[model samples]
Target: MENQQQTWIDLAIAAMDKAYVPYSNFPVGACLVSKSGKVYQGLNIENASFGLTNCAERTAFFKAISEGEQEFQYLVIAGHTPDPISPCGACRQVMVEFCEPTMPVLLVGDEGALKETTVGELLPYSFNGKDL
Candidate 1:
């Protein structure tokens, strides 16, 4: 992995440490880099209701968007799974809303295993605002 990717993975792991996972105990973290070079970190926050839980990827995107960072450069998601972690459907849709189709996304898993992909690759034929 490249140095910057490693750094993002490390940030995601650090963010994972702060996850609030009282139910499933599956902690996930995300690191998002904006076109302006700002970095945002987020972790999953579970709710007892289950349906109200917020994913780490969405948290990162929301945080950046709330702060007026629209254009994204990269995204990194970290988890303890056997393979690199994949974003949930909701998170993929959110990415399609705010991120460029070619924006890079990096998934980090156990032992620092990494998978490189793009937003469009993660959600093919996605539904976006243009379809509305």
Candidate 2:
């Protein structure tokens, strides 16, 4: 599990380097591996209208879903921040929609800081579209 998560961490950081962040200059990247062995990666995309921006976590998840991946087991998020930054509230909610409740979320920051947690722990009570 450690090795797998570490691999994703490296991939996440690598993806962050490709982020399109010309506004806040804060780059984020995320990578998720489906149970079927497919890998999906994404980088933060900023827009002139900040409200139109999309998070890296959701982008990666959606990209996978678009590719027909509906089940995931691992997620990795990386950024050039001081500490490990977890996913946003919206991303957390979207994650619970497709990933298992206890799916692992690996967060990494600059200087190799790493933390592993679960989606259920991050968002104790999650809801699907119908639940809302």
Best by lDDT: 1
- The local distance difference test score of model 1 is 0.94
Clashing pairs in 1: none
lDDT of 1 by residue, 20-47 (tens): 9989999999999999989999999999
Model 1 error, position 111 (Å)? 1.0
Can you tell me which runs of candidate 2 are displaced by over 4 Å? 129-132
Root-mean-square deviation of Cα positions for candidate 1 versus the true structure, in angstroms? 1.1
Highest TM-score against the true fold, candidate: 1
lDDT of 2: 0.88
| Each model's lDDT | 0.94, 0.88
- For candidate 2, write residues 19-79 as lDDT tens digits: 9999999999999999998889989999999999999998898899998999998999999
Measured by TM-score, how close is model 1 to the native structure? 0.97
Q: What TM-score would each prediction reach against the true structure? A: 0.97, 0.93
Total residue pair clashes for candidate 1:
0
